[model samples]
Structure formats: C-alpha cells, structure tokens
Target: MLKVYGRANSINVRKVLWMLDETGQSYSREDWGRGYRATGEPDFIKLSTFGVVPVIEDNGFVLRESHAIVRYLANKYGRTDLYPADLKARAVVESWMDWAQTDLYAAARPVFHAMIVNAADPATAVAPTDGVKSWAAQMLRLEQYLTGHGPFLAGDQFTVADIPAGLVVNRWFTLRFDKPSLPAITAYYDRLSERPAFRTHGRNGTP
Candidate 1:
C-alpha cells in the first residue's frame, strides 16, 4: 500500500490526494505538517531531508515533492490519459504543472499568508493589497492563456497538470479579497468544480 505523509488540508498534500482519487488508487495517509505532527521530527526528516509534507512511500520506494509524486503515480499506474505518453503532449502537461508551481504558486502564496494566515491573528495581519495586485496580474496571464486555450490548462483534456493549477486557482477564489473579473478563469474554475476528485481535494474550501 502507498503511504502518504502530510496533513489533509495542506495544498501540496491535497494535490497528491486529488491525484490518487483521480487515479482511483487506494492509499493510507499520516498527518505531518502544521497543526499536526511536525515534519521537523527526526523520523520525517529521514524520509524527506527538506522536511516537507506530502512525502510518499510506495512499496520500497520513498519520494517527496507533491508534483513528482503525482507524476510518478500516474506513470506507475499507466494513467496515460492523465500523463500522456506522447512526447509533445507530455511536455505540455509538464510545462503547465511547472508553471503552476513556479509562477502561479509564487503569486498566490503571499496573498494566502497575508489574507488567510495573518488575518486569523489580527495583530499580525499585513495588508494583502500588494499581494493581491501581483496575484491578479499573474492570474491575468492565466486568463489570457485559458482564453486562447479553452477549458483546461494543458489544452482540451483535464490532465495531471490541472491538479496543482486547479488548487492554486481555488485559493485565488476562496481567499477573501476583492478580485478583478476574469471570465475565462471563472469558466475554468467551474469546469474543474465539476470533477469529483477536484471537489473533494482541490476546492472543498480548505483554502
């Protein structure tokens, strides 16, 4: 059985869980993150030197990083529909996944920390104005891509790429901040919401 180590509400961990659900893979999970077991513990550090959540042990193989785990599982289970076998198609999927982590996540994190985390402690709350502005700018890029691309990030089909992308987009919508109207992104969010796996893990309102 695959063993996943991470808290359920973690964005990274939720990516893995959503992928598992999409692939219909059964796995057991352990909570190890904020509000749960600390990843700094020696045991977890031994598994992931970076001491991050969303580590996975499959059979005798140990792996960390949420995106890598999702890709690995898709390949391992022969879910070609999610992770394409075609070189170009696979590259497209990988590109969007990478963009989600690098570009999209970069903008979303600060906003999330300010609006969600810091807001919970009023004394510590920093105005999310700047973060929201930057995030909105980044999202505008996404809106343009989706406008031309239509439906999914990697094109027409929903792929493994959408897991991380969807989660970040959900955060954009869920966070309490005034947002610019982005029609294409709104449609994309609606499309993602229709997916049962996404509903359970990506947009179930944990963000």
Candidate 2:
C-alpha cells in the first residue's frame, strides 16, 4: 500500500488525495503539517528536504512533491486517460500543469496569504489590493484560455492537468473577495465540480 504523509486541509496534499481517488489507488495517509505533526522534524526532513506536506512512500520508493506524485501514479497505473501516452498529448497536459504550478500558483499565493491567511490572524494580514490585482490578471489569462478551449485545460479529456487547474479554480471562486466576471472559468469550475473526487477534495469549500 502506498503511504502518504500530509494534512487534509492542505491544498497540495488535497491534490494528491484527489488524484488517488481519481485513479482509485488505495493509500493510507498520515497527518504531517501545520497544526499536526511538524514536518520540519528529522523524520520528515529525511523524506523531503523542503519539509513540505504530501510526500509519498511506495514500497521502498519515497517521493516528494504533489505534481510528481500524481504523474507517477498515473504512469504506474497505466491511466493514459489521465496522463496520455502520446508525446504531443502528454506535453499539452504537462504544459498546463506547469503553468498551473508556476504562473497560476505564483499569482494565487499572495492573494491567498492576504485573504485566507490574514483573515484567520489579523496581526499577519497584508493589504490584499495588490495581490487581488495580480490574481485577477492571471485569472483573465485563464478566462481567455478557457474561452478558446471549452471543456478542460487539456482540451476535451479530463487529465492530470485539470487536477491543479481545478484546485486553483476552486480557490479563485471560494475566496471572499470581489472578483471579475469570468464566465468561462465559472463553467469550468462547475464542470470540475461534477466529478466525485473533485467535489470531495477540490471544491468542498476548503479554499
């Protein structure tokens, strides 16, 4: 059985859990992150140098990083539908995944820090105006892409690309800030929400 280490509320950890459900891959999970076990401890540090959540151990193989773990599971389980085998098709999916992780996540972090993180602890709140502007810009880019490509991030098929993309979309909608009207992203969020895995892990109001 695969052993996963992470907290349930973590966005990155939720990515892995959602993928596991999507693939029907059974795994046991241990809480190891904020408000739980400290990931900075030596035991977790040995597994992940970055001391992050969502590390996985399969047999003797240990892996860190949520995206890598999802891709690995898709490949190992021969879920070509999720992580296509054709080089070009896979590249398209991976490209979106990369964009989600880098560009989209980069834009989201500050807004999340300002809105969600700061809301909990007033002492740490930063002005959300600038972050919201940057995030809205990135969202406009997403809106344009989704308008051009209707169904999923990687065209028609729901792939690993949608995992990160869906989570981010959930956050975008769930955040309690005034947002620009984005019809395409709104439909995309609804589409992703139709999946059971996504409902359970992606958009169950955890934003």
**Could you estimate the TM-score for every candidate?**
0.95, 0.95
lDDT of 2 by residue, 32-68 (tens): 9988999999989998889998999999899998999
Q: Which lDDT value does model 1 have at 158?
A: 91
Query: Counting only residues 3 or more apart in sequence or on different chains, how many pairs clash (N, Cα, C under 3 Å) in candidate 2?
Result: 0
Whole-model lDDT per candidate: 0.89, 0.89
**Model 1: residue 50 alpha-carbon error in angstroms:** 1.0
Clashing pairs in 1: none
The segments of candidate 2 whose C-alpha lies over 4 angstroms from its true place after superposition are 118-127
**Model 1 accuracy (lDDT, Cα):** 0.89
List clash counts for every candidate, in order. 0, 0
Model 2 per-residue lDDT at 2 = 97
